[model samples]
Target: MPRRSEAKSGAGSAVRFFVYRSPMKKPNTSPAKATGRCALEWIRPEIRALRAYHVPEGQDLVKLDAMENPYPWPEGLVEKWLDTLRESAINRYPEPSPEALKGLLRKTMRIPDGMGVLLGNGSDELIQLIAMSMQGSRRDKPRVILAPEPTFVMYRLIAMACGLEFVGAPLRAADFSLDGGTVLDAIEKHQPAVVFLAYPNNPTGNLFDTELLLAILAQAPGLVVIDEAYTPFAQTSRMEWLRDWPNLIILRTLSKLGFAGLRLGFAVGHPEWMEEMNKLRLPYNINTLTQASLSLALDHFSVFEEQITRIRQDREKLFRALSAREGVTAWPSRANFILFRPAGKSADAIHAGLREQGVLIKNLHGNHPLLENCLRVTVGTPEENQAFLEALGIVGVK
Candidate 1:
C-alpha cells in the first residue's frame, strides 16, 4: 500500500499519514485451522465428557412432559401480578439476601425460626451451589456426592461438573422405593460429602419410606438435601426438620408451585452451611424483577394453593383412569404426576404415538434400568388430562 504525503500548511509540518503492508497470509487463528483440540481442551475433562441436558420441544402440544403446573394464573391474579411488576425498580439490583421474600418463604414453607434461607435463580442453581460448596480447597481427593439411583439426574451431573464423584445407590426394583440397607452400605463405602434425596421423587413420583430416609440421614457423613420441589402436591415438607438434623437442608422451589417462569428457589438450613454457600453465590443472582414478582405472588399464595389442590385431586383421578386401563400399570404418586408402564406395547412408540396425537408425556424408557418402559405424565387441567387419555388410548396403550 502506498503512503500519502502530509501537506505542509507552515514551514514545518508533522507527518499525518502512515501505511503498512498486509501479512502474506492471515494468521491461522481459526479453531479449524489450528490443532483439532482447541478451546474445549481448557474445559475440565469431566465437563467435556458430559452431554448437555436435553429438553424436548413442545410447541402446540398438550405439554404434559415436564412436571409443570398446567394451569395459568387466573386473569385477575395475573393483572395484579402485572401491576406489581410495574412497580419493580429494574434500574436497581435486588437485595443480596432478599429479606422480604425470604421472610415470606420462611413463613409459607414453615421453615423453623432461626434457620437461614438462601435463594437461587431456581432449584437447579441451588443444586449447583451445593456441589460447589462441597468442593472445598482440598482438591487433592475427589469428594463424593450420593443419591438414590434414577432419582434426579442433576445430582450426578452437577457433581461431575464440579469435579466431584457421584455415587448412586440403586432403589429397590420392586416398588421404586429406597433400599435402606443398600443405601447405608453405599454411604459407608463412599463416605460422601453430600447426599440428595428427592422427596416424593421424580419420574417414579413415589415418596420413599420415611424410616429409610431417616436412616440415611442418620448415617450420612456430611450434608443431606431433601428436595421438595413437588411438595405442593405432596402436602409434605421437611423444612421443619432443620432443628432435629443440623446436617439436613431443605430445598424448595416455587417452580412446581406455579411460579416456574419466575425461576425462584430457596434453600433453608442452618446458617453455618448457608453462610458458606452465600460466599460462592454471584451478586444479583436473583434479579429485581423476579424478586418483585415473587413478592406479589406470595401475597396471593392462596391462588397457587387452590391450583395445587386441584392438581392433587386430578392426580388421583388420572391414577385411577390409568389403573383402569388394560395392559397398563400406573404407580401411585404423591407428586403432581403419575408413572405408568404399558404392557404389550413399546413405551417409546407409545410416547411417539401420543406426540403424533398432539399430546406430550415423558418417556423414561432408557434413562435408567428401573425406569424401563415407564412413562410419566404431569396432571393437567381436566380437559388436557382427558385429551392425554384419549391420545394414550389411540396409541393402543389401553
Candidate 2:
C-alpha cells in the first residue's frame, strides 16, 4: 500500500509526492480460481477452523454475567486515586520491567522469596506468552497443551492458535470433580508441554482436590499452571508452592478484585521460567495509567478486602436462597459466584426471562455435557441479588 500527497513549493505550483508507503508486503488479492476461491484460503487451516469466543452485550441489563465485582471505590479513596493519577507522566514511556509495581505485587500477593513475577495485560495474555514460549525447537513431535474439560476455555484456545495439540481430559459428570486416574493416564499418554488447572473452576464453582493436584504435579513431565484468578474470593493461595515445585506457576489477576478495567495479571514462578516468559512479553505492556491506578489502589487494599468479605457472605446467602428454590440445585462455591442447574425448566428460557426483566447472567445450557442445564450468577450487592431472585420468581422458576 502506498499513499500519494501533493506539496506546493510556491503559491501556485503544486507537486505530487509519495509521502507515505507501507514497508511490508500487502495481502495477496489475486483470485485463486479454485472450485471456491476466497481470502480465507490464505489463512492457516487450523486458524480458519477456529470459532471466536463470544461475549454477550450487557448494555442496559443488571450485568451479572462476567463475574466482575459490582462495586466502586469509596468516596475518599476515589479522590486520592485521582490525585495519584494526576502525578503520572503520560508523555514518557513506562519502565519496561516496572520494579516498583513488582515490589508491590510481591508484598500484596505474598509471593515467596526467590520467586520471579512477570506481568501481563491480563491472564489471557499471560496464557498466550506461555503458549508461545512452549513452541519447542523440535517440530517432529509437536508440543501438547492439556487441561480438564469444562475448565477455562483459553487453555485450549491458545494452544490451537499457536498450532500445538490440545488434549482435554473429561471431568467426572457427577459433580465436575477431577478424576485422578483419567488425568494421570492422559498425562502419561500426551506428555503435554503445559497443563492448566483453574482453581475453584469456573462455571463449576468448586476447587479440585489438593491431593489429586499434587499427584498430577509430581507425575507431570512439564510445566503446570495453576490459574488462581478468583483467589481473592477463595481466600487462599498456592503462592508458597513456587518454592517447592520448580515446574509450577501460579497465575493471578486483579480483575475479580474490582480492577477488571485495568486488566492486570501476574505470573509467579521460578526465575528460569519467568525469564523466558519475560522474553516473549512486549515492551511496556503495562501502561502508565494502569500502573498508577494499581499503586494507588494497593495503598487502600483494605477497602477491596472489605468488599471481598461482603461478596463471600453474599455468595453464601445467594447459594442458600437458590438451593431453597423448589426446582433449582445449586452447587457449593468458594469463588464469588454460584452455578446451578434448573431441574424442571429450560435454562435458556429462564436466561431470556431474566434478560427481559433487566437482569443478565450466563447460560451454559449447551456448552458441555457436564454443564447441560447450568447457569452461573456472580454474587452482587444485596439489592442486585434480590433483584435477580425476584426475576427468577417472576419467570416461575420453582
TM per model? 0.91, 0.90
* Model 1 backbone overlap count: 0
Candidate 1 structure quality by residue, lDDT tens digits, 1-398 = 76666665576867577676665875678768455555456667778788898899999999998899888888998898889888888877788778998888877777899998999999999999999988853347788999998887889999998888888999888788888889999999988999999998987888888888889889998999999988888888777778999999999899988878889998989999999999989899999888988888888899889989999999899999999999888899999899998899999999999999999999989889988899999999999999999988888966
Model 2 lDDT tens row, 1-398: 67788888877889887866559876766565542465356667888787899899999889899999999889998898889889999999987888898999888888898898999999999999999999863458779999998988888889999988999999998788999999999999988899999997987888899999999899899999999999888887877888889999999999999999999999999999999999999999999999999988887788999999999999999999999999888989989889998888889999999999999999988887888989999999999999999999999885
Model 1 lDDT, full chain set = 0.88
Clashes of each: 0, 1
Q: Kindly report which residue stretches of model 1 are placed more than 4 angstroms away from their true locations once superposed.
A: 1-27, 34-36, 136-140
lDDT of each: 0.88, 0.90
Alpha-carbon RMSD, candidate 1: 5.5
**lDDT at 393 for candidate 2?**
95
| Reference-based TM-score, model 2 | 0.90
Residue clash pairs of candidate 2: 327-398
